[model samples]
Target: MTEGIRSGTAVGSFWAEEERCGGRAVALPSWLLTTSNEEVAATVARLYGGQSRSRDRQQDLFELTLDNDAIAVNVDGPEAVVNRLVLQQVEEHAPIHVCDGFNFLQPMDNAGDPCGCPESVFDRKAAARSGRGPKPDARLAFRLAAAPDLVIFHLTSSTWEFSDSLSAAVAGMERGDNGAQMTISLQRKAVTTRSGMAVSYVRPILSVIQQEFAAPGQLRLAA
Candidate 1:
């Protein structure tokens, strides 16, 4: 018999949720892998074997704790990820403008005219931070290396670091003829601001584990 129909293949999202602390939102230490699909929840439970909990009142949001700093992943190709800059007004669901930092991917008026965004990534980041322009919007889709056939897990981030590293990472992956094996980790770092105040934060990192390029007169073989 044919397999059951799959409507939404995305299993879940790996992300960090902020908590209320001292009347302000603070980032949590570990990442949370949450899903709303039952099948995805079951798959996650089977693979990770972690204690799952309902995070919402409707009991639809199932959250799995990822205490480890890193997880193995397999990316089908560069096309599996999309990183862009988007500008949205307050309470707007759709962005007013979108670009790749250098060029306008979505024109302001859909007239094919230039968006006039800053050409430099730094300048664009400043504009976004100052609420004058777009901010980073990135998404990645991959399968767990431990259970490749289970489901596709996704991660979405608006962090500037992730956006800045996308081009270089994708370029390295493109060098290979097939998919890439990689590790997605949460890296922690501390920095002192010019004001002499030290701040620490955790950011998600994507490190390619292996890239196989085709040799002269031969097709690349899968690992």
Candidate 2:
């Protein structure tokens, strides 16, 4: 799944259906996914685990801390199956330039792909030179990684829509007669300085999958 994500195949997906209040449903948060255990553990260990770190786990809630930055996972609400995960910087860091831009996409060349090919092109320099690109604004970076039912994120300056997709999928399940679940993956390169102190989360390489319904009551999942 991670490999597929890296090659730009798997993406956030959501399915909607209508179901009764009771059914077989599963909510697997990223932390609960075993495939990413090594990666997540290594990240924490390298970044803030050990002497400088404090960790705690209580039932469905888990927490890890390093200096002023912290990451937490807890059950999401009246819905015990769902989870809410968050990362926060206790003390704001120096402002950094963050830019969000769109580009014209190009068709993939399978022949050049395995070897080398420019899948999409964005003339950032040209835009900047022509004053078409917006001025860099001070902001933070947030990068996310995912595998099927799990998602991990590093606080920095990127946008994520995993929750939205999950909600849509759950809504679909609620509307369907049979139970449903989905798994998707995401991968993207993260940017960091030599010291690794200054970091930036690049935007995801692939587009997210989405589903929408005009009628609200058509499908509603458990809270």
Candidate topping TM-score: 1
Q: Model 2 off-target regions past 4 Å? A: 1-160, 184-223
lDDT digits (tens) for residues 1-223 of candidate 1: 0011122457678875343533222455777788878777777667666566546555768887765778887777655677777787655556788766655776555534567888777787788777899876776777788887766777766777665555556676556546677777887999999999999998777777775422122111111
lDDT of 2 at 214: 23
For candidate 2, give the lDDT of residue 34.
Answer: 15
Q: What is the C-alpha lDDT of each candidate?
A: 0.66, 0.26
Q: Please state the error at residue 39 of candidate 2 in Å.
A: 22
Each prediction's number of clashing residue pairs: 0, 19
lDDT of 1: 0.66
